[model samples]
Target: MHDIAKVTLQNEMDLILAHKRSMRLAELAGLSLSAQTTFATAVSEVARTCLESGKVSYLILCVNTDQRDKFIVACLKNEQLNSNRSREGLEHAKKLVNKYNIFTSGTETAIELFYYIAPHFRVDLEKINEWRQLFRNEPSISPYEELKRKNEQLQDLSEKIQKSEAHYKTLTNSLPLTIFSLDVEGKLLYANEWLERYTGHTIDYLNNSQWKTIIHEEEYATFAVLLNKVITQGTATIKTQARLKNKQGDYIWHQVSLSPFRNEQGDLQYWIGFIVDIHAQKVVEETLKDNIELKNTQAKLKENQRTLEKYVDELNRSNLELQQFAFVASHDLQEPVRKLLFYSDYMVSNYSGVIDEKGLGFLSSMRSASHRMRNLIQDLLLFSQINKERLNFTDVNLNEIAQEACQDLEIAIEEKKAVINMSGFPVIAGDASMLRQLFENIIANAIKYSRPTQAPVVDITCKQNAGFVEIAFKDNGIGFDEKYIPQMFRLFQRLHDRTAVEGTGLGLAICRKIVEMHHGTIWANGQEGEGATFFVSLPLNTPGN
Candidate 1:
C-alpha cells in the first residue's frame, strides 16, 4: 500500500477534503479529467454517508498492488455499525467505482471502493511520496475562496439529495404497503402514496389528523395510546394489530410496526412505521385456536376413560381376592364352626341328665351362640361372592322367584305364622339366583321383625312401568325410623337388639349388592310403628341395555 492522503470525516468540510484527495490521487496516477471527477464523486458520496451518521469517520486514499494488478483505493471506515443508514449512499457510490467491497468486524465497518491503474503508468513509491509531500506543503486558499468552494459543494450535494429523495418516493409508492414517518411530537412527517390511496385521504388531511380518521373506532383509543407511548419514550420499537378502514368503507385487519430512528448520539429523530395487511393470517390463527380447544377437550375425555378403565381393572382384581377369601372362609372356617355346633348340640343332648339346671342353661347358650356364628359365616360367604362373579341373565318369572323364596323360608314363616299374600307378577330379565336371594332376604326380614302383637303378613305385588318391573313387598312388621334409611342397606347395620331379632346384620346388605349387580334399585318407605314397604325396580331389558 502507498499512502496518498487521509482525512477525518467530521463535517461538510471533511467531505470536501476526501473528494479533493481522491481527485488529486487519480490525476497524479495519470487518470483523465472524466475519471478524476467520477472517482471524486464516488468518494464524496461515501464520505457524506459517514458524516451523516453524526460520528467521526476516516477516509483513507491510497494505492494498493496485488500480484495481478495495481489499483487506487478509497476506503471509508467508521467505529460504529451504522451501515444500514449508509446503504443508499454506498449503493450510489458502487455504480461510479470499478470495484467495491464492504466488511464488518465487531462494531466497526469499512467500505472500500477501487479503481484499476493502467499498467503502462510507471507509478512507484518515490512518486507516491512526492504527491503526499505536495499535499502537506500546499498553500491554503483565501477565506473568501474557501467559502465559495464550500457553497458550490453544498449546492451539488443538495441536488443529489433531492434526486435520491424523489427516487425513494417513487419506489415506496409502487409498493403494496403503507409507509409512514412521524416526529417526536406524534406529528405526521411523511406518508407514502399507498396510504392516501387506501384511506381515500390526501397527505394534507393525514398531516392534520395524524391518520387517526382511518383507524377503526373500536381500536382508535388503543392505537392512540401506543402512539403516545412511543412518542413519549422515543426509545422503543412497538408492534400491534388493528382494523384499518379502506376506501370501500370496509374495515380490514392490518399489522402496524413502529421503530425509533436515532442518530449515532442516540437522540430520537423520527418514528418509522409500516402497515401490512394481515386479515388472512388473523383468520387462520382464530380457526387454529378453536381446533386446539376441541382437541384438548377430546384429550381430556380420553384420559378420563383411561382412568375409569384402570379403576375397573383394580376393582376386578379386588373382587378376585375376595372370592378367594370366600372360598377359604366357607371351607376352612365352616368346618370348625360346624364341629363347634355339633359338639355343643351333643353336650346338650347327651349330658342333660348328668348336668344341673344351671349347667344345662350354659350348654344351651353355647349351642345358640354357635348357631349365630354359623349364620354369620354363611352371610359373609354370600356377600363376598356377589361382586366376584359376573351376572348370568335370563328371562325370569318374578312370581316363581317369590314362591321359591317363600319355600326356602317356610320353616321360619311357619314358626312365625306369617301370612304371605301373592299378587300379579311380571317376567323380567335378571339373574335368577340373585333375584331369588333378594326376595328371600326381604321376606325373612319381614317375618323376623313382625310385631309381637300381630301376625306377620307380607303382600308381594308387581307391575310394569316405563322400562322396568316394579315389585313392592308390603310387610306388616315393626317399622323403622325414616332417617336411618341410608344405613339400612349397609353391612352390619343392625336396627334392632340382637336378642330381639336373630340376624347376622348382612341380609339387607347382600340384598342391596344383588340389586345393584342387576342394575336395579331398592328402597324402603316407612315410619316408626308403621309397616314398611320395600320397592324394587328392575329394568325390563338386560342390565347393559
Candidate 2:
C-alpha cells in the first residue's frame, strides 16, 4: 500500500475537504459516479466521528494491490480514543463500502475502507501519479464558500473563548510572569495580577502613568522606541530586554515581547505582550564576564586540548602499524601464489606427455585462480594505501594524467578498437599517481564493458566550476541502471558478473578514495544499454597543499 494523499481532520471544514478529495480520487480510479459518491460518503462519516471526539485525526488515501485485485484504500485514525465511541457510525460506513475493518491498539483506533477496482479498469503508478497531481491542482473554493468557512471558524473560536474566559483569567493571575493586552490605538486594555503585585501599582495607575513608575528610566527610552515602532508599523513580533522596578525598589532584568495579533482578513487587531524575569541569567552573564573566571575557563580548555592531542597521537601510531601489516601480509601471501603459477606452467611444458587433457585443464585452472588471487591482493594493498596522510600534492596537468592512463590501457583499447576523445584538460593541485590511477580504472572499465557489436567510444571533457574543476569521462559501453551507481563504488561491490567482466571490484572504490583525499567528489550517471558518464570534481586550491 502507498499513500497518495493525506488530510488532517481538525474541524467540520476539513471533513468536507476530505469528502471532496475522496470523490475526486475515486473518479480518477475509474469508478462510476454512484460508486464514487458512496465511497466518499463512507470516508466522510468515519472522519466526522473522529473529529467529534475533540482531537485531531488523520485520513490517508492509498493505493493497495494484491495478487488478483487493486483497491483504493482509506485509513482514518484517531489516537485519543481507545474504545469504539462511534460504533453505530462505523457500522453505517461499513455498509456503504465494499470492505471495511477496524483495528485498535492501546490508545489508537484505525478504520480502513477498501473499494476494489473492477478487473477491466486499469490502475498503475502512472495513473496514481495523475491522481496526486490532480489533487494538488484542484481549484480553490469559491469566494462565498471561503467566507462562510472563515465565519464558521470564527464563531467556533468565539464560543470557545467565552466558555474558557474565567479559567483563562485564573491561570494568568496565578502565573509568575506578566501578561497584558493593548488596543489597536495603543491604549492599555488589561494587565494580569502578577504585574500589579510585582510593581506595587494598580491597573488604573499603570494606565495613567504609562508604566513609568515601574520601568527603569535608563531602559524605558529604548523600550518606548521599540514599542512605538511596533504600534506604527504593526509588523512582526519584537523582543527586548529591560529593567523593571519591583515592589522592593530593585530594578530587575526582564525579557519583554510584543506581537501584533491580526484578524482573519489580515488586519492588525491589537497587541499581546509578556514579560518574564531574567535577573538570574543576567547575573550569570556578568559573572562569566569577569577576567578571573574567563582565565580559569581558558586553563581548563587547554587541558582538554592536550588530552585530545594525546589520544590523536596514539590513534595515528596504531593506524601506521596496521597499514604496514597490510602491506607485509599482502607481499608475504603473494610468494606462494607466484610459485604455484610457475610450477603449473612448468608441469604443462615438461609433463605434457604423461598427463591427460583433463589433468592439463586442472593445471590451467590452478594457474588462472592463482593469477586472480594475486590481482586481488594487489588491488587491496592499493586501496588501503590511498589516504589523506599519504597524499603528496603537486601542480599536476590532467592532460598528462589522461595520456598516462590511456597508455596503461593501450592493449585493451586496441583489442576493443576504442576511440578516445580528450579535451579541456586543466592544471590542478593533486596527487599525480593517484589521479592517473583514477583515470586508468574508469577508462579501462569503459573499454571492458563496451557493447560487443560496436566499437567503444570514450569522451573525456572538463569544465571549470567555482573554485573547482569538473572532469567527466563518458563512454559508449553497455552501461548500467543509475540505481546501481552507489553499489558500484563500494569495495567488492560489482554490478556485472565475474565471468562477464574481470576485476577485483575495487577500481571505483579506489577512485573515490583518491578523490576524497584531494577534498573532491566523484559521481556517475547512466541508463541501461545507453552508456554512462563518471564525473570527478577536484578543488582548484587543494587543501593542505
Candidate 3:
C-alpha cells in the first residue's frame, strides 16, 4: 500500500508540471505573433511536444479577436485516446496544424502535413499573402473611437446640469420670503435676490456680515443661541420675532424661521431659513387686543351700573313687602293667641267643677295647637327676612361654625342617639351667620331623619380645593331617590310624606340660595335604599363683595 501511494503522488506531480509548461508556451506564442503563419507554427510546436510526451491524448487549438481588440486563444483535448497512444499522438499533431490561418479547410492530418512546409512553398504562401493584404486595406474604426464618443456624452450631461441649477436659483429668488443659507459657523453662504432687494443691497454686500449687522442688537444674543442649537441638533426649526433694519433705515418686526439642512451623512452643513415682514400683522394684533380689552372694561362698567340699579329696586321692594308681612303677622297671629288664652281662661274659671277628664283634655289640645301655629308663623317671617337681606362677607372659620351649630343642636343629637362626624374645614369668606345656619339645617335634617335607624351615623367631612371648599354630609337614614334631587332644593318641595317627616321644606332651599350667592354650588347624591350625601362647594371668596 505504501509503494502504491508513492507512485500515485509521483504521477500527480508529473501531470501538474506538464500543464504549467504547456500554458507558458501558449502565452509566449500568443504574444510574439499576429499573422496566421507564425501563430500556427508556434501552436503546432507546443502540440507536437505534448504528443511526444504522451501527456495530451487529443488536442485542438482555437483563436479569436475580442471587443478590446485583443486576441483570445485556448487549447482543448480528449482523454479517451489514451488507450491508443499512437493514434493520440498523430491526432494531437494534426490538431495543431488545423490552427494555421492559411489552411482553412481539410482533415486534421491533411492540414497538419500540408501546412507544415506549404508556407515556404510558392503555391500556398503566395495565395495567403494576397488575402492578408486585401483584408488589411479595408476601412474600420479602432476601439478607442467608441470610448471617445461616450466621453462626449458625459460632457453634454454636465452642461445640462449646470443650466438646470441656474434656473432653480432664478425661481428660488422670486419668492416673497427672504431666503438665505448660512454655514455652521454662522457665515452667510447664500442669499436670494429678494434679500438683496429688501435690504437695498447687492448679493455680494449681503453675503458678508452685513446681514448680522442689520439685526437689532437686542435680539442678536437670542438669535445666536437658537442658531447654534439648530446646528448642534442636526435639524431644527423655530419661528421667532426679531427687528430687522429695512431699506428705509427703520427697524421693522419680522418673523424669522431657521432650519438646519443636513447631508446624506446626517452632518449639518448649513442652515436654510426664511424671513417675512410681520410689522403690519403685529400692529393689527396689538390694536385688536387693546380694543377688546377696552370693550370689556366698558361692558363691565355698564353691567355694574345695571346691577346696582336692579339691587336698589330689589331692596325697595323687599322693604315694602317686609313691612306688609310684618303688619299682617303681628295683627293676625295675635288675634288667634288671644282667643285661645281667653277661652282657656273662661273654661277653667267658669266650668272648673263641671268639666270632665275628656273635656279638659280637649281644652289642653286646643291651646297646644294654637301655640304651635304661632311659632310656625314666626319661623316663616324669619325665613322671608333672611332672603331680603344681603350677605355680610368676612373670613369665617367653617370648622368652628359647624362646632357651634352642633352644640346648639346637642340635645336633639343626644336624645336621638345620632353620631356626628366633623372633620377638616377651610376658612371661607362668607356671612358667618349664614354658614352657621347652613350647617344647622343639614345637621338637623340628618338627626331628624335618622330616628328610624338602629345606629344613626352622620359623617361630616370637608376638603379644600384650588378655588373652592367641599363640605360633604353623608347620612345613613331614609334616603330619597335621585330623581327628586332637582326638586329637593325648591322652596316648599318635600320628598317624604308630611305625616312621616316634620319639616317646612325650607331648609335645603335656603342652603342652596346661600351657596349660590357666594358663587358656589350644592348637590345631593344618593339612592333610594342607601343614605344621602349633600355636597356643598363654596368659593373661598365671595363675588362682588
Better of 1 and 3 by lDDT: 1
For 82-157, candidate 3 gives per-residue lDDT tens digits of 2354355445544644332222222222112222222222323344344334333423244443343355457778
Model 1, which residues run further than 4 Å from truth? 1-317
Error of 2 at 73 (Å): 99
Worst 10 residues of 3 by lDDT: 1-10
TM-score of each: 0.45, 0.45, 0.40
Q: How close is candidate 3 to the true structure, as a TM-score?
A: 0.40
Q: Could you give the C-alpha RMSD of every candidate to the true structure, in order shown?
A: 21.0, 29.8, 28.3
lDDT digits (tens) for residues 1-545 of candidate 2? 87888777887778888898899888877889999999999998888888888876889999887547788899999986443756767877899987987788888888999987774656777877887887666664766445654665688799999879878888899888999987766566788888888998887787678778778888887777544635456467878899999989999999998888888998888789889999999998998889897889899999999999999999999888868867775878788988998998899889988999999889888988988888888888888888777788889999998999999999999999999999968889989999999999999989988999999999999999888999898998988998888798899998988888888898999989889888899999998899999999999877754
State the lDDT of candidate 1 residue by residue for 1-545, as single tens digits.
77677777777767766787788888887889999999899989888888888776898898886436778899889876366758888888899988998899877889899987784656777777898888666554557436644675688799999999999999989889999987777777798988878889987786678567889888887678555744457458888889998899999999988888889999988889999999999987887888978789889999999999999999999878887889988899899889988887888778889999999898888888888888999999988878525688889988898889999999999988999999968888888999999999999998899999999999988888889888898998999999999999999999989998899999999989998888889999997788899988889988567
Assess each prediction's global lDDT (C-alpha) against the native. 0.85, 0.85, 0.65
- What local lDDT score does residue 482 receive in model 2, on the 0 to 100 scale? 89
